[model samples]
Every structure is written in structure tokens, then in C-alpha cells.
Target: MQRQPIAEAVREDIVNGKELVFVDFDHTLLACNSSELFIAACKPSWLVACIDLVVRRLIPWKLTHVPHWYRLRDYACCALIVLLCPWNVMLWKRGAPDLFRRHESRELAVSLRACDPTRLVIVSFGLQWIIRALLSESSWRDTPLVATPNLAGPAYFSSGKLDIVRAHYPDEVIARAACISDSLDDQDILHAVGKGVLIEPQGDVYRAEEHLYLPLRYTAAAKYARSYVLDQFLFVDVLIVIAATSFGFSTLWQACLFVPPLMLSLMCVYELGYFENDMVAARKEVAPTLTAKVERYRTYPIGFGAWAWALVLGLLGVLLGWHFGALRSETLLVSAACWLAVLAVVRAVFFAYNGTATRWRAFFYPVLQLLKYGSPFVLILASLPGAVLVLSQIMLMWCSYLIYRAGGNNKAFNRDVLRLMMFGLGGVCLAASFRSAPVEGFFPYAITAAWACARVFKAPIMRACKTLRSRPARRSETAL
Candidate 1:
């Protein structure tokens, strides 16, 4: 016998007084996109995947928002999906179950449990096969699914969803239905429905109970103050200060007295810069859709309280600096003047860095890094060897950041290479330290080398131990 149509079946269920509820799958029910998860699960080369992500996912996604570009974007997305279908099919079958369990939106999942099974329907612009594979053993497995069927044509999206749903149900049925989605693209269907539930990000998880209306305004209160404070705790800057003081001053007691207040003032100023940078980023946001606007609002929520706290902290830093003889002409005046000048220049560079175009940001980043690493030099009257040691450390840090950003297919290989580089830098510092003063040069180099080794090896050693512990459990499971 032939199977009944999906819309006909769904309409039959809705006829029994249960209002139809159409829920989006990706980003609404799950914390991430299903297609991206599938790509990751395929275990392709990292570089290839990164490139694919930018070209296929990011570019097409951005293009979809441009006027009159929807068709082109859809065609491009569909073509890329078709090209990757074979690989996706081969991998998703094995990985879907695990991916579903790991990435399901817990808050949404809880809310969904209270939803009437008969009234609920899973609708997605993602591949039907992939979604089906993911939900094979899930609670929603038997629920009606309205998804893009095959590589037949462009995926149903925006108003297309409304048209597809209308094919299944009459105008009256649609008039009384509800749509739960994260994207503003679903606004057409949402307006047609009786109720609209919007999914929103709350810290680490997603919540979807908020009633969605067009022209969504910024409403979330400042919740990221603690996060901002934590971000400003620049321990590396403190280390640089300590290294400079130890080498420049006659006694270690001077470092003890000077480092704290100096660091406080520096961190406070840096945090103000961070706030400015955040504001700049917020201003540059292109949020055409209500959903995009809401997300962007949440990301850069108005937080004058944070600004106030930063100012207070900065005042406290200044007070502490004054109390610690930071204002004293003999101990801190010349150094402070020099440090202030450097700080002024760096802060100006930071402003320029924020204002510069995206392509030019890379050029400014290294200069900012140098300011961060080399500013401590003003605290000390440094010899050539001591300066070389500091410069060497700065280069090491800059190179490490670049390596991390330029991720490759083999992460382990990249990590090993970074470790070797760290060791080599440490050895160079150790040799240079022998030629300089004992207290200033030797001690700073020793501390720098030790810190580098500790930081580099800590994560890998922890991972190795974790793997070793897990091996026994895996072996036992295999035997069973």
C-alpha cells in the first residue's frame, strides 16, 4: 500500500483540537548546526574543513541577508551540499547518534518534553537524511518531519517553509499553528501561526520560551560583568612587570613593592581599552533581521555598570600606585614617565587598531603585543643582553599565537613543534642570562624559561594522563 502524505497526516492529527507546533531543528533544539556537526564528525582535514566552513557555510549565510541574493545563496548552499552529500552520508550514519546526545539544547529539550506529541512537528532546512539519522533512536523519531527531501532542489527556507507547511495544512490550520525557531527567516510562518516561540542564548545554553515579535528590541540586562573582569586579569603583563623590576632594581623587595600597583594601573587602563573595543565591534554589527538584532544585542548588551566598575578599579589602581611610591620622584618618576609615554603610545595604537579595517588588524596586533611584552622594560635600566632576552620572549609569544590561529590538519604535530620552539627559546635565554648581571639578567631568564616550559607542557601532560586512565576502561568494555 502507498504511504499517506506528511501534510495530510499532520493535518489529521491537528484536526483533533491539538494546535500544530512546528519546531526548528538547528540552533533551536540543538546548540549547534547539524550540518556543521556532520562535517566535524566526518573527521576531514582541519584545513579543508575550515576552508569549506568559510566558503560554503559562512559566505552563503552572509549572502542570504543581502537583497535579491536569496536565490543565488540558496543555489550555492544547495550545490555545496550536493557536492558533500556522499561524504556526509558515509559519516553521519556512524556519528549522528553521538552528536545528537552531546549537542542537544537542554533547556529546549526540557520544554519540548511538555509539548504534545501529536501537535509537535520537526521542521528543518537541513538535510532530511541527516536529521533522520540523528533522531533514529530519539524520542521525536516517530514525529512528522518536514525537511528538504533530497538533492532535488534548494532547501525550503524563509517563506518557502510557509509554502511547504501550507501544502500540508489549510489556511485555517496554519492560522492556528505555532512556530518555534531561532532564525528571523521564519518570520513569515511565525506571523501566520497563532503563537511564535523564539530561541535565545543564555550564557552556555539556549532557551526557547520567549514570545517572538518583529523588530525585537534589546532587553537583556548586563550579565557579563564577571566575565569582563576575569578577561582583564592579564597575568602575563604582571610577569613582564616582575621580570623588568627584578632586573632593573637593586633588590627583590623593590619588585614586591612596585609590581602590584603598576600592574593594577596597567590592567585598569587595558580594561578600558577592552570596553572601547567592544563598543567598536557593536557599532560595526550588521543586524538586518530581528533574530540577528536580538543575538547581537545579547552579545553586546548595554552595561554602563561595567564601565563604572572599570573606572572604580582604575581609581583604586591609581591610589595603590601612589601609596606604593609610584609617584615618588627618586624611585618611580623617570621610569613612570617613560612607562606612561609608552602606555600612551600603545593605547593610541590600540585605538588605531580597533578603528582599522579587518585586513589591517593583523599588522596592529603584533605592535600591541610588543607593547604588552616590552612595556615592562621602562621599569628597568636594562643592558643589551637583558633587552635581547625580553625581545626573544616577546617573539616566542607572538609566534605561538600565530601558530594557534593558523591551525593545521595535525594538531598534535603543531603542538609538538610549538614545544620544540619553546625549548629552543628557553635555551637561548639561558645562554644570554650568563653574560648579564646575576639578579636582573639570570633570575629573569630562569623565571621566563621555567614559565614557558610549564605553560607549554601542562595541557599535553594532562591529556596524556587522561588517555592512560581511559585505556583500562576501554579494554574492559571490549573484553565484555
Candidate 2:
């Protein structure tokens, strides 16, 4: 979505394989409005108020940081965020049914990965957790992520964002190429880049003072995106493929007696590798010092060991069927269900370790985690983290997701999601313990009830949550 001369300039750098800085998220790089869609998914009420405030000029991006504007920002933001909305769910994913209505805003992330992977870099201002999680699974992982740090107290990172960039990379330095935002808030960071491009929306104009103004006609950009992919886009296509293939295989196997279930389970687990949603990437801004650190840890192994586990599961599933009651439709279904539970466990471990959380997603996440863990681990084969993981997942789905549908707060990972996930874990145990059909059906329900009870019993917002909060710490501005 980089308009006119800026797009042409950046594209030239990308094609030439010259070093360049790519700074954009929404419209310019991404095709969808990631932020608005995410906010709509959870906190629909707050979405309108925030956007309306921006339109009404109740809050302004601080170019000069006038006292009134700061005060207005504080008040408007406070009132708008009566409750903090978690950014974890806002990821740039590849596959999921698009039955839901999508939203549009200035937030875009996928565009960066799609347009140019080699020379392009992300320069955005999204939260670090959301940004990192999205980029970890991205083709753009090779590129650096230089974004505005989180601002949630010592536990969060914010303020001195541009200052930190400058201390690392001085303005006098020449970058191969650069793109800057038109937001007055981006002036400092923009000025630091070599060839800053100003992104002015329709009807908004700024008189140039320090840099050249790059006017991108909005209508032209939109028209271009209709036929062509944006520069940084990465997902959506692959996700559609994943969803279609999985759904198709599931339906095809619906009538089959043995292999279909395992195939479906494999696909579900495979989906875990596709990460969460996101809007923008961190701003690289043509600063090597800034870009270097961001690139180092961008790609975290997604669904860590999904493929290996799926293979092992397939082998075991075939072996079990061939040796025992291979023809039993019930056996295949149960095995598939068990694998589903395993996939959920895999995701649970990811959430525990990486702090990744997705609403309703946690239901299926645990088994995925278990599959990944139990696949290569000889220890799991011996004791069956496989069984334990599956039981735990079912316990959670029946107990947590089905029971306490509206309870967990994602904005802050409290004990609710924990207890809910545990319900799944416990369900797995209970189901395994009881072989009877009546008990199996009831166990999930019972687990759901327990999760709900726990949710109701515990403090809605577990004040003492977040391990990072316990120790007093200081982050020097020079932190990468």
C-alpha cells in the first residue's frame, strides 16, 4: 500500500537486491486491518470509542507533545481502555475459515512478508509480544522487527522508543533506502531513516519542513491491492489452503473406517504451526543497529515439533489398527480424538513456555503441544505424556472451553485460562481412567463444570498474576 513514488522507490530497492529499510504495516504492506479486526473479535465496545476519538480529534498524535494533547491522550486512552484488551490474539495467521466478518483499519502485517522477503524490513509500533509472536512464524522472520516497545509499567515497554533508536543508530548515518510514516508521532523515527517517505491518507496534508512529502493516492493503492498482493503480505492464502485441505480430508475420511481420523488429526496439529494474528511489524527505519538485534530472535520454532510427532502418531495409529481391531470405526474415531487431545497438549506447553494464548484456540492447543512433545521423546513413549497430554486436553475442552466460555481474560493471562487448560488436562486423565462410554461422555462435562466453578471461585482479575511482576527490575533504554 505504499503509494506512488514511495512504492516505486521501495520496489526498485527490493528488485535490485539492494539493502533497504521497509517501514509500514497497514494498507502500505498488509491487506487487512489487523488491529481493528482483533479489537472487534474481543472488545467490540471499546473499538468504536477509540476510533471515534481519533476522528474527532479528541486525541492527537504528538508531534510537539503539547501539554493539552498529552492530557487529552491520557484521558481518552484511559476512558477508552476501561479494561485492557490483550494483543496476543492479534496475529497474522494463514488458515482459518473466513466465515466471520473482517474489519479494516490502518493496521496491516501480512503485506511485508508477501511483497519482498529478502530486502524488506518491518518498522512498526505494535506491542512486543504480539509483534514477536506474529513474526516468529513469518517469512519475514529473516527481517528485523523494530517497533515501539510495550508500555505496561515495568512489566511493559514504552516511551523513549525513538530516543532508543537514535542512541543506537544516529541520524547522520545513511541507509540504502527508507520509508517513514506521515503520522506526526513518527517524525523523529522517520527523520532518522535515509529516504523517508511520508504516507498521507486521503484529504490529510502536511506542509513539508524537514523532509520530502510522499503523497500516496489512497484510491490507487486500494485498486492495486484488489488485483495484486501487497508488498509485505505473507499469510491468508496458505491458511485458506490449510483449512480447505483439512476440511476436505476430514469429510473424505468421514466414511472411511481406519485412516481418515489420523489424517484429520495430523492436519489439525499442522494448523498449530500457523501463528496468531498481527497488524504491523516493528519499525526497522533503516538503522542497522536497530535492525540487527530484531533479526536475531525473530523466528521461534512454531508448533515446535509438529511434523515429527504427526509422523510418529501416524505410524502408531496404523500399527494399532492393524494389530488390534483395525476395522472398528469406534477405534479409529477414538484414536483420532485421542490425537486431537494430544495436539491440544502441544499448544498448552507452547502457551506455558512461550506465553502464547488464543481464545477458544487453547481448546485445541494442548493436544498439539502433547503431539510435539511425545513424538520424539522416548520418555513420553515410556510413560505416555501422550496419554497424559490427551487426557488433560479433553478435560480442558469439556471443562474450560465448553463450560466457562466467557470467563478467561486474555488481556492479562490470569489463573482462569490456566485452570481452564488444566481442566482439559484433568479430563484427559479422567477419560483414560474410565473406559466406559457413559463415563467418557460425562467426564468432559464434569471437567467443564469444574473449570467454571474454579473460574467463578477465583478472582476475576488475578491481581498477583504474571511472574515478571514479582521482581523489581529496570530496563536500560539501550535494551534491544
Candidate 1 lDDT: 0.55
Q: What is the C-alpha lDDT of each candidate?
A: 0.55, 0.39
On residues 1-480, what C-alpha lDDT tens digit does candidate 2 reach at each position? 343443444344444544455555433443332233232233333243344345324434575454334433433343344345443244223211131112111233332333455556565544433345444544455576665444533211234335444444555542445654534555555565666665543221111110110111111122124222321111212111122122223322321333333443343343333221210111211221122222222332223334444545555654554444332344555555555565556545544433333344455544554453233221112112223333443443344443443565433544346544564566567558666653223333533344335553445444455445776788988999
Distance from true location, Cα of 127 in model 2, Å: 2.7
Cα shift from native, residue 243, model 1 (Å) = 3.8
lDDT of 1 by residue, 257-322 (tens): 555555554443454455456555436534311223234334432233333333343344344444
- Candidate 1 residue pairs in backbone clash: 247-440
lDDT of 1 at 132: 89
TM-score of each: 0.39, 0.29
Off by over 4 Å in 1: 1-235, 247-261, 271-344, 380-390, 400-441, 464-480
Clashes of each: 1, 59
Model 1, clash count?
1
